[model samples]
Target: MIEKIEDIKRIELSQFKFPVNVYLIDDLLIDTGFPRTAKKLLSYLKNKKINKIVNTHGHMDHTGGNSLLQGYFRCRIYHYPAKRSYTVVEKLLFGNLKNFTSETPPEKINTDNYSFEILYTPGHSDDHITLFEKKKRYIFSGDLVLHGEAREVSRDVKIYRAIESLKKLRTLRPEKIFPGHGEIFYGYEVLDEKIGYLEDLGERILRLYEGGKSVKEIVKIVFGGERFPYFFIKGYFSCENLVRSYIKDPKSL
Candidate 1:
Protein backbone atom coordinates (compact mmCIF):
# COMPACT_ATOMS: atom_id res chain seq x y z
CA MET A 1 0.00 0.00 0.00
CA ILE A 2 1.23 3.47 -0.93
CA GLU A 3 -0.02 6.60 0.75
CA LYS A 4 1.03 10.15 0.19
CA ILE A 5 1.39 12.50 3.11
CA GLU A 6 1.82 15.84 1.45
CA ASP A 7 5.13 15.44 -0.45
CA ILE A 8 6.21 12.16 1.18
CA LYS A 9 5.30 8.78 -0.31
CA ARG A 10 5.00 5.98 2.25
CA ILE A 11 5.45 2.48 0.84
CA GLU A 12 4.52 -0.52 2.94
CA LEU A 13 7.22 -2.88 1.71
CA SER A 14 6.71 -5.63 4.26
CA GLN A 15 3.53 -7.73 4.04
CA PHE A 16 3.79 -8.76 7.70
CA LYS A 17 0.84 -8.26 10.02
CA PHE A 18 2.93 -5.46 11.48
CA PRO A 19 4.37 -3.71 8.44
CA VAL A 20 7.60 -1.79 7.88
CA ASN A 21 7.27 1.41 5.90
CA VAL A 22 9.77 2.98 3.50
CA TYR A 23 9.39 6.65 2.83
CA LEU A 24 10.31 8.32 -0.42
CA ILE A 25 10.66 12.02 -1.04
CA ASP A 26 11.81 13.00 -4.47
CA ASP A 27 15.06 11.10 -5.21
CA LEU A 28 15.75 10.12 -1.63
CA LEU A 29 14.45 6.94 0.06
CA ILE A 30 14.34 6.93 3.86
CA ASP A 31 14.67 3.16 4.28
CA THR A 32 14.74 -0.13 2.40
CA GLY A 33 12.38 -2.59 4.06
CA PHE A 34 13.76 -6.14 3.69
CA PRO A 35 16.01 -8.20 1.42
CA ARG A 36 13.21 -10.53 0.30
CA THR A 37 10.96 -7.57 -0.47
CA ALA A 38 13.61 -5.75 -2.49
CA LYS A 39 12.26 -6.92 -5.85
CA LYS A 40 8.76 -5.87 -4.97
CA LEU A 41 10.02 -2.51 -3.78
CA LEU A 42 12.17 -2.23 -6.85
CA SER A 43 9.29 -3.03 -9.22
CA TYR A 44 7.15 -0.45 -7.46
CA LEU A 45 9.79 2.21 -7.94
CA LYS A 46 11.06 1.05 -11.32
CA ASN A 47 10.35 4.33 -13.00
CA LYS A 48 10.84 6.60 -10.00
CA LYS A 49 14.06 8.49 -9.66
CA ILE A 50 16.31 7.18 -6.86
CA ASN A 51 19.69 8.82 -6.56
CA LYS A 52 20.19 8.48 -2.81
CA ILE A 53 19.13 6.12 0.00
CA VAL A 54 19.28 6.85 3.73
CA ASN A 55 18.78 4.08 6.25
CA THR A 56 17.53 5.02 9.71
CA HIS A 57 19.80 2.32 11.13
CA GLY A 58 21.68 -0.85 10.24
CA HIS A 59 18.98 -3.33 11.26
CA MET A 60 18.30 -5.90 8.56
CA ASP A 61 14.56 -5.26 8.39
CA HIS A 62 15.45 -1.68 7.51
CA THR A 63 18.60 -2.24 5.47
CA GLY A 64 17.91 -5.62 3.81
CA GLY A 65 17.36 -4.11 0.40
CA ASN A 66 20.47 -1.94 0.57
CA SER A 67 22.72 -4.21 -1.51
CA LEU A 68 20.11 -4.82 -4.18
CA LEU A 69 18.69 -1.31 -4.41
CA GLN A 70 22.11 0.30 -4.31
CA GLY A 71 23.42 -2.15 -6.91
CA TYR A 72 20.50 -1.37 -9.16
CA PHE A 73 20.37 2.39 -8.83
CA ARG A 74 24.04 2.82 -8.01
CA CYS A 75 22.81 5.34 -5.50
CA ARG A 76 24.92 6.30 -2.51
CA ILE A 77 23.67 4.75 0.74
CA TYR A 78 24.00 6.75 3.96
CA HIS A 79 23.51 5.58 7.53
CA TYR A 80 24.83 6.04 11.06
CA PRO A 81 27.55 3.53 11.94
CA ALA A 82 26.38 0.42 13.77
CA LYS A 83 27.48 0.52 17.40
CA ARG A 84 27.78 -3.25 17.48
CA SER A 85 27.82 -6.21 15.18
CA TYR A 86 24.73 -8.20 14.29
CA THR A 87 23.89 -11.24 16.39
CA VAL A 88 24.16 -14.74 14.94
CA VAL A 89 20.37 -15.03 14.87
CA GLU A 90 20.10 -11.69 13.10
CA LYS A 91 22.52 -12.82 10.45
CA LEU A 92 20.62 -16.07 9.98
CA LEU A 93 17.23 -14.37 9.80
CA PHE A 94 17.98 -11.31 7.67
CA GLY A 95 21.60 -11.53 6.47
CA ASN A 96 24.39 -9.07 7.27
CA LEU A 97 24.47 -5.34 6.53
CA LYS A 98 26.81 -4.52 3.68
CA ASN A 99 27.24 -1.86 0.99
CA PHE A 100 26.41 1.05 3.28
CA THR A 101 29.03 3.60 2.21
CA SER A 102 28.34 6.69 4.27
CA GLU A 103 28.45 6.88 8.05
CA THR A 104 27.55 10.54 8.28
CA PRO A 105 24.33 11.52 6.53
CA PRO A 106 23.91 15.22 5.93
CA GLU A 107 22.35 17.00 8.90
CA LYS A 108 19.65 18.23 6.55
CA ILE A 109 18.42 16.87 3.24
CA ASN A 110 16.50 19.13 0.90
CA THR A 111 14.19 18.31 -1.95
CA ASP A 112 12.56 20.83 -4.23
CA ASN A 113 10.53 22.30 -1.38
CA TYR A 114 10.70 20.16 1.79
CA SER A 115 13.62 19.85 4.21
CA PHE A 116 14.26 17.02 6.68
CA GLU A 117 16.59 17.16 9.64
CA ILE A 118 18.29 13.94 10.68
CA LEU A 119 18.16 13.56 14.41
CA TYR A 120 20.29 10.87 16.12
CA THR A 121 17.81 9.41 18.54
CA PRO A 122 19.15 6.09 19.78
CA GLY A 123 17.69 3.53 22.25
CA HIS A 124 15.82 1.12 20.03
CA SER A 125 19.33 0.66 18.67
CA ASP A 126 22.48 2.62 19.32
CA ASP A 127 22.42 3.81 15.73
CA HIS A 128 18.71 4.57 15.41
CA ILE A 129 17.62 7.98 14.12
CA THR A 130 14.51 9.94 13.19
CA LEU A 131 13.81 12.30 10.32
CA PHE A 132 12.14 15.51 11.37
CA GLU A 133 10.47 17.97 9.02
CA LYS A 134 10.43 20.96 11.35
CA LYS A 135 8.09 23.20 9.45
CA LYS A 136 5.48 20.44 9.12
CA ARG A 137 6.09 18.97 12.60
CA TYR A 138 6.34 15.46 11.17
CA ILE A 139 8.79 12.86 12.51
CA PHE A 140 9.77 9.72 10.65
CA SER A 141 10.40 7.80 13.84
CA GLY A 142 12.43 4.71 13.00
CA ASP A 143 11.66 2.28 15.80
CA LEU A 144 12.36 5.13 18.22
CA VAL A 145 8.65 5.38 18.96
CA LEU A 146 6.41 2.38 18.33
CA HIS A 147 2.63 2.30 18.63
CA GLY A 148 2.35 0.75 22.11
CA GLU A 149 4.23 0.26 25.35
CA ALA A 150 7.88 -0.81 25.21
CA ARG A 151 7.81 -3.85 27.43
CA GLU A 152 10.48 -6.17 26.06
CA VAL A 153 13.53 -4.74 24.38
CA SER A 154 16.20 -6.54 22.35
CA ARG A 155 19.59 -7.37 23.88
CA ASP A 156 21.33 -4.35 22.39
CA VAL A 157 18.69 -1.85 23.44
CA LYS A 158 19.62 0.73 26.09
CA ILE A 159 16.45 1.55 28.04
CA TYR A 160 18.05 4.66 29.48
CA ARG A 161 18.90 5.96 26.03
CA ALA A 162 15.44 5.13 24.75
CA ILE A 163 13.87 7.14 27.56
CA GLU A 164 16.22 10.07 26.95
CA SER A 165 15.46 9.93 23.22
CA LEU A 166 11.74 9.98 23.92
CA LYS A 167 12.25 12.99 26.14
CA LYS A 168 14.14 14.70 23.32
CA LEU A 169 11.38 14.07 20.79
CA ARG A 170 8.74 15.05 23.30
CA THR A 171 10.34 18.47 23.39
CA LEU A 172 9.99 18.57 19.60
CA ARG A 173 6.25 17.97 20.00
CA PRO A 174 5.73 16.28 16.68
CA GLU A 175 2.28 16.64 15.18
CA LYS A 176 2.52 13.32 13.32
CA ILE A 177 4.81 10.34 13.75
CA PHE A 178 5.59 8.01 10.83
CA PRO A 179 6.81 5.06 12.78
CA GLY A 180 9.01 2.23 11.47
CA HIS A 181 6.19 -0.13 12.36
CA GLY A 182 2.40 0.37 12.54
CA GLU A 183 0.23 3.11 11.00
CA ILE A 184 0.94 6.80 11.11
CA PHE A 185 -0.06 8.46 14.41
CA TYR A 186 -1.27 12.01 14.85
CA GLY A 187 -0.37 14.47 17.64
CA TYR A 188 1.65 13.59 20.74
CA GLU A 189 -0.77 11.10 22.27
CA VAL A 190 1.03 7.95 21.11
CA LEU A 191 4.44 9.44 21.81
CA ASP A 192 3.42 10.48 25.29
CA GLU A 193 1.77 7.10 25.86
CA LYS A 194 5.05 5.26 25.19
CA ILE A 195 7.07 7.68 27.30
CA GLY A 196 4.65 7.36 30.20
CA TYR A 197 4.59 3.57 29.97
CA LEU A 198 8.37 3.26 29.91
CA GLU A 199 8.84 5.67 32.80
CA ASP A 200 6.24 3.94 34.95
CA LEU A 201 7.64 0.59 33.96
CA GLY A 202 11.13 1.65 35.05
CA GLU A 203 9.86 2.79 38.47
CA ARG A 204 7.92 -0.44 38.89
CA ILE A 205 11.01 -2.37 37.95
CA LEU A 206 13.14 -0.45 40.42
CA ARG A 207 10.65 -1.05 43.20
CA LEU A 208 10.57 -4.73 42.40
CA TYR A 209 14.34 -4.79 42.47
CA GLU A 210 14.36 -3.03 45.86
CA GLY A 211 11.88 -5.63 47.05
CA GLY A 212 14.55 -8.22 46.26
CA LYS A 213 12.82 -9.68 43.24
CA SER A 214 15.32 -11.41 40.98
CA VAL A 215 15.52 -10.49 37.32
CA LYS A 216 13.85 -13.77 36.40
CA GLU A 217 11.03 -13.16 38.86
CA ILE A 218 10.73 -9.56 37.75
CA VAL A 219 10.43 -10.68 34.15
CA LYS A 220 7.63 -13.08 35.05
CA ILE A 221 5.70 -10.49 37.06
CA VAL A 222 6.31 -7.56 34.77
CA PHE A 223 6.25 -9.05 31.27
CA GLY A 224 4.95 -12.59 31.72
CA GLY A 225 8.48 -13.78 30.98
CA GLU A 226 10.06 -14.04 27.58
CA ARG A 227 7.78 -16.26 25.43
CA PHE A 228 7.71 -18.13 22.14
CA PRO A 229 9.62 -16.39 19.32
CA TYR A 230 11.54 -14.40 21.89
CA PHE A 231 13.09 -17.60 23.21
CA PHE A 232 13.75 -18.68 19.66
CA ILE A 233 15.97 -15.61 19.27
CA LYS A 234 18.30 -17.08 21.93
CA GLY A 235 17.51 -14.37 24.46
CA TYR A 236 18.79 -11.73 22.07
CA PHE A 237 15.30 -10.23 22.19
CA SER A 238 13.68 -10.68 25.56
CA CYS A 239 12.14 -9.08 28.65
CA GLU A 240 15.30 -9.79 30.64
CA ASN A 241 17.19 -7.37 28.43
CA LEU A 242 14.87 -4.54 29.43
CA VAL A 243 15.16 -5.43 33.09
CA ARG A 244 18.94 -5.56 32.85
CA SER A 245 19.23 -2.19 31.17
CA TYR A 246 17.33 -0.39 33.92
CA ILE A 247 19.01 -2.37 36.67
CA LYS A 248 22.34 -1.30 35.25
CA ASP A 249 21.38 2.36 34.88
CA PRO A 250 18.75 3.29 37.45
CA LYS A 251 19.80 6.91 37.57
CA SER A 252 19.56 7.54 33.82
CA LEU A 253 15.81 8.17 33.57
Candidate 2:
Protein backbone atom coordinates (compact mmCIF):
# COMPACT_ATOMS: atom_id res chain seq x y z
CA MET A 1 0.00 0.00 0.00
CA ILE A 2 1.03 3.60 -0.54
CA GLU A 3 1.12 5.97 2.42
CA LYS A 4 1.11 9.73 2.26
CA ILE A 5 3.38 11.37 4.83
CA GLU A 6 3.08 15.12 4.68
CA ASP A 7 4.45 15.90 1.21
CA ILE A 8 6.23 12.53 0.74
CA LYS A 9 4.72 9.33 -0.65
CA ARG A 10 5.76 5.96 0.78
CA ILE A 11 5.52 2.58 -0.98
CA GLU A 12 5.53 -0.01 1.82
CA LEU A 13 5.83 -3.78 1.25
CA SER A 14 6.47 -6.94 3.33
CA GLN A 15 6.59 -10.05 1.10
CA PHE A 16 10.39 -9.85 0.76
CA LYS A 17 10.97 -11.20 4.32
CA PHE A 18 12.31 -7.79 5.26
CA PRO A 19 9.99 -4.80 5.36
CA VAL A 20 10.54 -2.34 2.49
CA ASN A 21 9.66 1.34 2.47
CA VAL A 22 10.62 3.40 -0.58
CA TYR A 23 9.93 7.11 -0.68
CA LEU A 24 9.03 9.35 -3.60
CA ILE A 25 9.77 13.08 -3.57
CA ASP A 26 8.66 14.69 -6.85
CA ASP A 27 11.01 13.36 -9.55
CA LEU A 28 13.49 12.08 -6.95
CA LEU A 29 12.97 8.42 -5.94
CA ILE A 30 14.66 7.43 -2.66
CA ASP A 31 15.71 3.76 -2.47
CA THR A 32 14.12 1.43 -5.03
CA GLY A 33 11.95 -1.39 -3.68
CA PHE A 34 13.24 -5.01 -3.53
CA PRO A 35 13.33 -7.48 -6.49
CA ARG A 36 10.06 -9.07 -5.42
CA THR A 37 8.32 -5.73 -5.51
CA ALA A 38 9.86 -4.37 -8.74
CA LYS A 39 6.68 -4.78 -10.78
CA LYS A 40 4.63 -2.85 -8.27
CA LEU A 41 7.42 -0.30 -8.04
CA LEU A 42 7.27 0.28 -11.79
CA SER A 43 3.52 0.69 -11.73
CA TYR A 44 3.86 3.29 -9.02
CA LEU A 45 6.41 5.24 -11.02
CA LYS A 46 4.51 4.90 -14.30
CA ASN A 47 2.50 8.06 -13.77
CA LYS A 48 4.71 9.78 -11.21
CA LYS A 49 7.29 11.08 -13.74
CA ILE A 50 10.43 9.87 -11.97
CA ASN A 51 13.76 11.24 -13.25
CA LYS A 52 16.41 10.17 -10.71
CA ILE A 53 17.19 7.58 -8.04
CA VAL A 54 19.13 8.13 -4.80
CA ASN A 55 20.03 4.95 -2.92
CA THR A 56 20.50 5.39 0.82
CA HIS A 57 22.91 2.48 0.96
CA GLY A 58 24.20 -0.44 -1.11
CA HIS A 59 22.23 -3.14 0.70
CA MET A 60 20.64 -5.70 -1.66
CA ASP A 61 17.04 -5.16 -0.58
CA HIS A 62 17.50 -1.41 -1.02
CA THR A 63 19.24 -1.39 -4.39
CA GLY A 64 17.84 -4.49 -6.16
CA GLY A 65 15.37 -2.55 -8.29
CA ASN A 66 17.84 0.12 -9.41
CA SER A 67 18.58 -1.65 -12.68
CA LEU A 68 14.95 -2.42 -13.40
CA LEU A 69 13.78 1.11 -12.76
CA GLN A 70 16.71 2.62 -14.61
CA GLY A 71 15.92 0.43 -17.64
CA TYR A 72 12.34 1.71 -17.61
CA PHE A 73 12.95 5.41 -17.15
CA ARG A 74 16.55 5.69 -18.40
CA CYS A 75 17.19 7.52 -15.15
CA ARG A 76 20.48 7.89 -13.32
CA ILE A 77 21.26 5.97 -10.12
CA TYR A 78 23.29 7.92 -7.53
CA HIS A 79 24.96 6.55 -4.40
CA TYR A 80 28.17 6.79 -2.39
CA PRO A 81 31.48 5.53 -3.78
CA ALA A 82 31.82 1.77 -3.73
CA LYS A 83 34.30 0.63 -1.04
CA ARG A 84 34.99 -2.60 -2.92
CA SER A 85 36.38 -2.67 -6.48
CA TYR A 86 33.91 -3.17 -9.35
CA THR A 87 35.34 -6.64 -10.02
CA VAL A 88 35.17 -7.45 -6.31
CA VAL A 89 31.58 -6.22 -6.11
CA GLU A 90 30.66 -8.27 -9.21
CA LYS A 91 31.86 -11.44 -7.48
CA LEU A 92 29.54 -10.91 -4.55
CA LEU A 93 26.12 -12.63 -4.36
CA PHE A 94 24.27 -9.39 -5.14
CA GLY A 95 26.39 -6.95 -7.11
CA ASN A 96 23.43 -4.80 -8.17
CA LEU A 97 24.95 -1.80 -6.38
CA LYS A 98 27.70 -1.64 -9.02
CA ASN A 99 25.07 -0.74 -11.66
CA PHE A 100 25.53 2.91 -10.76
CA THR A 101 28.12 4.98 -12.70
CA SER A 102 27.24 8.26 -11.02
CA GLU A 103 30.09 10.61 -10.25
CA THR A 104 30.44 11.77 -6.68
CA PRO A 105 27.10 13.50 -6.03
CA PRO A 106 26.99 17.15 -5.00
CA GLU A 107 26.74 18.21 -1.34
CA LYS A 108 23.35 19.80 -1.98
CA ILE A 109 20.76 19.19 -4.71
CA ASN A 110 18.11 21.71 -5.73
CA THR A 111 14.68 20.53 -6.76
CA ASP A 112 11.64 22.55 -7.80
CA ASN A 113 10.54 23.22 -4.22
CA TYR A 114 13.33 22.07 -1.91
CA SER A 115 17.08 21.61 -1.63
CA PHE A 116 18.53 18.34 -0.22
CA GLU A 117 21.92 18.11 1.49
CA ILE A 118 23.59 14.70 1.37
CA LEU A 119 24.92 13.74 4.79
CA TYR A 120 27.25 10.72 5.08
CA THR A 121 25.78 8.69 7.92
CA PRO A 122 27.66 5.40 8.18
CA GLY A 123 27.12 2.43 10.59
CA HIS A 124 24.41 0.49 8.76
CA SER A 125 26.93 0.31 5.94
CA ASP A 126 30.23 2.07 5.31
CA ASP A 127 28.83 3.86 2.26
CA HIS A 128 25.54 4.78 3.89
CA ILE A 129 24.33 8.35 3.43
CA THR A 130 21.21 10.35 4.34
CA LEU A 131 19.45 13.13 2.44
CA PHE A 132 18.51 16.10 4.56
CA GLU A 133 16.31 19.04 3.52
CA LYS A 134 17.41 21.99 5.63
CA LYS A 135 14.48 24.39 5.22
CA LYS A 136 11.82 21.95 6.42
CA ARG A 137 14.19 19.81 8.52
CA TYR A 138 13.32 16.49 6.83
CA ILE A 139 15.73 13.54 6.81
CA PHE A 140 15.69 10.64 4.37
CA SER A 141 17.44 8.42 6.92
CA GLY A 142 18.28 5.06 5.30
CA ASP A 143 18.43 2.25 7.85
CA LEU A 144 19.80 4.23 10.78
CA VAL A 145 16.57 4.19 12.78
CA LEU A 146 14.79 1.05 11.55
CA HIS A 147 12.95 0.56 14.81
CA GLY A 148 13.07 1.57 18.46
CA GLU A 149 15.93 -0.92 18.88
CA ALA A 150 19.11 -1.95 17.09
CA ARG A 151 18.35 -5.51 18.20
CA GLU A 152 19.20 -7.27 14.91
CA VAL A 153 21.99 -6.45 12.45
CA SER A 154 24.76 -7.82 10.24
CA ARG A 155 27.62 -9.36 12.26
CA ASP A 156 30.31 -6.95 11.14
CA VAL A 157 28.50 -3.72 12.21
CA LYS A 158 30.59 -1.57 14.58
CA ILE A 159 29.16 -0.77 18.03
CA TYR A 160 30.63 2.70 18.56
CA ARG A 161 30.18 3.92 15.01
CA ALA A 162 26.45 3.15 14.97
CA ILE A 163 25.97 5.01 18.26
CA GLU A 164 27.99 7.96 17.04
CA SER A 165 26.04 8.05 13.79
CA LEU A 166 22.72 8.34 15.61
CA LYS A 167 24.17 10.92 17.99
CA LYS A 168 25.35 12.98 15.02
CA LEU A 169 21.85 12.84 13.48
CA ARG A 170 20.36 14.07 16.76
CA THR A 171 22.40 17.24 16.43
CA LEU A 172 20.73 17.94 13.07
CA ARG A 173 17.28 18.17 14.67
CA PRO A 174 15.47 16.53 11.76
CA GLU A 175 11.77 17.08 12.31
CA LYS A 176 10.69 14.26 9.99
CA ILE A 177 12.61 11.06 9.16
CA PHE A 178 11.80 8.84 6.16
CA PRO A 179 13.62 5.54 6.67
CA GLY A 180 14.16 2.82 4.02
CA HIS A 181 11.80 0.50 5.88
CA GLY A 182 8.68 0.76 8.01
CA GLU A 183 6.63 3.92 8.58
CA ILE A 184 7.79 7.48 8.02
CA PHE A 185 7.43 9.93 10.89
CA TYR A 186 9.27 12.13 13.42
CA GLY A 187 12.98 11.60 14.31
CA TYR A 188 14.58 12.53 17.62
CA GLU A 189 12.45 10.22 19.80
CA VAL A 190 13.32 7.14 17.73
CA LEU A 191 17.02 8.02 17.81
CA ASP A 192 16.87 8.23 21.59
CA GLU A 193 15.05 4.89 21.79
CA LYS A 194 17.48 2.96 19.53
CA ILE A 195 20.54 4.49 21.22
CA GLY A 196 19.15 3.54 24.62
CA TYR A 197 18.51 -0.01 23.39
CA LEU A 198 22.14 -0.33 22.29
CA GLU A 199 23.39 1.00 25.62
CA ASP A 200 21.15 -1.42 27.55
CA LEU A 201 22.32 -4.29 25.37
CA GLY A 202 25.91 -3.46 26.29
CA GLU A 203 25.20 -3.27 30.03
CA ARG A 204 23.27 -6.56 29.99
CA ILE A 205 26.08 -8.24 28.06
CA LEU A 206 28.58 -7.00 30.65
CA ARG A 207 26.47 -8.33 33.52
CA LEU A 208 25.95 -11.66 31.77
CA TYR A 209 29.67 -11.99 31.08
CA GLU A 210 30.49 -11.35 34.75
CA GLY A 211 27.93 -14.04 35.70
CA GLY A 212 29.98 -16.51 33.57
CA LYS A 213 27.51 -16.84 30.72
CA SER A 214 28.91 -17.91 27.36
CA VAL A 215 28.08 -15.98 24.16
CA LYS A 216 25.47 -18.54 23.11
CA GLU A 217 23.94 -18.47 26.59
CA ILE A 218 23.81 -14.71 26.52
CA VAL A 219 22.03 -14.88 23.14
CA LYS A 220 19.43 -17.26 24.53
CA ILE A 221 18.88 -15.17 27.62
CA VAL A 222 18.52 -11.93 25.67
CA PHE A 223 16.66 -13.06 22.55
CA GLY A 224 15.01 -16.33 23.65
CA GLY A 225 17.17 -18.40 21.26
CA GLU A 226 15.50 -16.82 18.24
CA ARG A 227 17.36 -16.53 14.98
CA PHE A 228 15.76 -14.60 12.15
CA PRO A 229 12.25 -15.58 11.11
CA TYR A 230 13.33 -16.49 7.56
CA PHE A 231 15.26 -19.70 6.86
CA PHE A 232 17.65 -18.65 4.08
CA ILE A 233 19.01 -15.65 6.04
CA LYS A 234 18.54 -17.26 9.44
CA GLY A 235 21.84 -16.45 11.10
CA TYR A 236 22.62 -13.30 9.17
CA PHE A 237 20.64 -11.18 11.66
CA SER A 238 20.00 -12.31 15.21
CA CYS A 239 20.70 -11.71 18.87
CA GLU A 240 24.18 -13.26 18.43
CA ASN A 241 25.09 -10.47 16.03
CA LEU A 242 24.30 -7.74 18.60
CA VAL A 243 26.07 -9.78 21.32
CA ARG A 244 29.17 -9.95 19.14
CA SER A 245 29.16 -6.13 18.97
CA TYR A 246 28.92 -5.97 22.76
CA ILE A 247 31.67 -8.55 23.29
CA LYS A 248 33.90 -6.64 20.90
CA ASP A 249 33.77 -3.69 23.31
CA PRO A 250 32.38 -4.40 26.77
CA LYS A 251 34.09 -1.23 28.00
CA SER A 252 31.87 0.77 25.66
CA LEU A 253 29.06 0.40 28.21
Over the stretch 1-253, how does candidate 1's per-residue lDDT look in tens digits? 9999887899997645547889988999988988778889999988888988888887778887877888788888778863336777787666566654555688988877678999999888888888888999989888888866776667778888888898899899899998887689899777778888888998999999999999999999998877745455747767888898888854653
**Over the stretch 121-197, how does candidate 2's per-residue lDDT look in tens digits?**
88776778889899998989888878556666774466767778888888888898888888876757877777788
Question: Against the hidden reference, what TM-scores do the models get?
Answer: 0.92, 0.86
The candidate that achieves the highest lDDT relative to the unseen native structure: 1
lDDT of 2 at 120: 88
Measured with C-alpha atoms, the lDDT of residue 158 in candidate 1 is 88
Clash list (residue pairs), candidate 1? none
Q: Which 10-residue window in model 1 sums to the lowest lDDT? A: 228-237
